[model samples]
Target: MLEHGAAPPSSEPPTAPDPVPSPGFVGRLARRKPVELLVAESGRGEGGAALRRTLTMWQLTTISIGATLGTGIFVVLGEATPLAGPAVAVSFVLAGLTALFSALSYAELAGSIPVSGSSYSYAYATMGELVAWICGWCLVLEYGISVAAVAVGWGEYLDELLHGTFGVTLPGAVSAPLGEGGYVNLPALAVIVLAMVFLMGGAKESARINTAMVAIKIMTLLLFCGIGFFGIQAGNYAPLAPLGAGGVSAAAATLFFSYIGFDAASTAGEEARNPQRDLPRAIMLSLLIVTVLYCVVALVAVGAMPWRDFAGTDAALARIMEDVTGLGLWSVVLAAGAVVAIASVVFAVLYGQTRILFAMSRDGLVPPVFAKVNERTGTPRANTVLVAAFCGLLAATVPLGELANATSIGTLFAFALVNVAVVLLRYTRPGMNRTFRVRFFPLTPLLGFGFCLWMMASLPAVTWAVFSAWMAAGLALYFLYGVRHSRLAVAVAVAGRD
Candidate 1:
């Protein structure tokens, strides 16, 4: 049998024009790019420029934390609290566990494959080109739309901060979209552009700034916990699961969005100083830190404020701070912190999106412009600028209510593919060296895939319909462009001629 990612051995005479039959259409679609080729091609860019590998494990961890820990904690509790009451804390744990299973699979693959494409590359090396393209398409939605979504959320916190600090706020015409009862959302566009500027400076610099912002947000949450702890009433815990197990499950799906950015580290595989070792450690460590912080903050927020009162709350954490302190001082502080927190999410997630496109472009699955690197900064400057423009425009003009759920479903789909790819790689390349392995092998990855499906099922049917339409569009694009331009297909064709 032919080895995965390798061409078939030839048996024809050397004089034959074609030594072997070229891979059939199905075979071309399923062709796995050799891992060695992928690694060898890593960091390569037009004009001999390459991505700089300056990120340490700590920076990688902070990147993931900065990406995953911000927007959800600052805003999602209000949405989930009414669903599960005080048991929202349990909902967070349940969501974290679901993320844990996928994180394990991600860690294993990131350690072994260690490419900038994240799950997309893992799928390419195990599943096939078609699956890889689908995974990559899903990532585009996950990171791109999520960045816009987070940017839109940033505008709300900015309004809160400005209103608290100064005597006034930006007019709704400037702060919100037309669909949301205003003109363009200038604040959202401004925040996306700000994050783009940081990313354009390069990954290491972006990571440094992101780490600082992450520290501030962490301290902010800790401060909230400390102040809010004093107001905890055991009475709030009376009707723990008021809405029952179904509510907990529903809330868990909502909370799952909080876990989305934990895989941001995996997207930095090409930039990591020691990808095989550091990537896995960063992924797992970041998940651990984010989960602990989430569970702790959820408990404190629920204990400090009754779940029934959480229904209409927007910034639940800041409101809780006000209730606990009997002063707007801490509330303003939390709002200010949320602004910084959401900005970090925009920065980190945008960085991941650009890198994913970089990988896809290198493989000829996307336009070459995305793979071009700036010689001075060692960054994909044009790519960053383009992605920023798109996301910023989306944030400025779109009413992203149901669209936000599309981001979650897209992420869940990509994560499920990652879990499946990890298992396939284990079977196809058992001898491949891995710095980290998913414990219990098949069981671990199987559970990861199952959990992804469960959370996806919990989403609204409208989200599924949206996902299906997006996928259909992707398939059409792949057939029209990606399949014809794919480097793997070209390589296979050339090998057959030899």
Candidate 2:
């Protein structure tokens, strides 16, 4: 007979203890070093057959600024200003702060472990094989789709310049991509191809072209900002926070995506003269410069036009200039600047993405062929071609807004992960030689993490869904191929034997 309160046990089997340790904030970070080992496995060492270290600190900073300053300021500002009003200025500040946290973390990690793969390599070194694979997948979406989205933006501005300067308009079928009643985005594809050619030639050539384009873009933006400030009317400031705090925060999250390219500076670690010192300097410097530029641009944009009128407008900066100057001349100049700027962004982003793939392939996380550098050019020719083809297809076909949102979600997710990695690394490897550290350690990273999470939450529900789906696919691939092929996993097994 059973005791009064006693009952028969249910048929469910006893639960198994968890296989992986519960990743507390600290415990999770302890995993960063192993991730670094994974990154090192793919290297031919710093002085190997890869492209020689040729980039100066100034070039790296310029590439970062050039990559980040394009579509976000010139185009997204108009869209976000309407949503947040004059508070868009505050939004830029918030986004910059958030970016600063991550940039600081990147500087420290990059200094200790200067490599070319960016966050994916960082994740591999700090997290594990699986996390590294997922990070790489996320980066593909971030950089790949961004290249395409930026290219489409270039097409719009190119059409505007052509029409304004010569009274000639390319047919919609030729100027726009399909579904917009266009046959192909000829200019967009052409830009991608040109970038590929430049990349395949060599890093020095690419850097020279990028430097020139960056100078042009910066000059145009400064000119616009200078002129627009004087044209500012106080009436535009009516209802400063039109959408209120919530809207401003939301806009900051979206606009933060505009700041994504600054990390590209760190990706050129292997090519920096003194990566440990210069990488951090370049990363922080570029972020600082771009933030100031963004703040000024946002201020002038809101001052020049009412927030309500900017919604759903494609090229708001050009539109604002046309409104203020009334001369088609300024519009043409702005349009030309937009075209050059967005094209430069595509070149920088695509180059970064291909290099990441090259590193991963060299590590055996992906096919080895991607790591194959052309001995003559010292570029990952196969990877560049494949990436360019995919980007071109997307630019020639897909809608820009969908691609932009997807890219933003991927970027924010990668950023959030990096901040978390920073906090984890602090306790796990306190004695690791860090050249540049985030000022307040746990607090700064925590703030950065919170801001990133906030931005992620602000994204459209559909964007989240898409991101989730992409991650799921990435996990499946990791299990199916990356896990078995990973160089780090093999190293771990060998260490166990020894």
Per-residue CA lDDT of model 1 for 1-498, tens digit only, reads 001122233243333122122357887788888787778888887567999999999999999998898878988988999999999989999999989999989988888888899999998887788999999999999999899999988998888888899968899888888778898999999999999999999889999999999999999999999999999999998789999999998898888888989999998998999998898889989998999999899999899988999997778998888888889898789888999999999999999999999999999999999999999999999999999999999999988887777988999999999999988888866767677777787988899899889878878899899899889999999999999999777776788667
lDDT of 2 by residue, 342-414 (tens): 8899889988888778777776778877777776777778889999999999888776665567877788777
TM-score of model 1 vs. true structure:
0.94
Clashes of 2: 7
Report clashes for each candidate as comma-separated counts.
Answer: 0, 7
Which residue pairs collide, candidate 1?
A: none
The C-alpha stretches of model 2 lying farther than 4 A from their native spots are: 1-48, 399-403, 495-498
lDDT of 1 at 279: 89
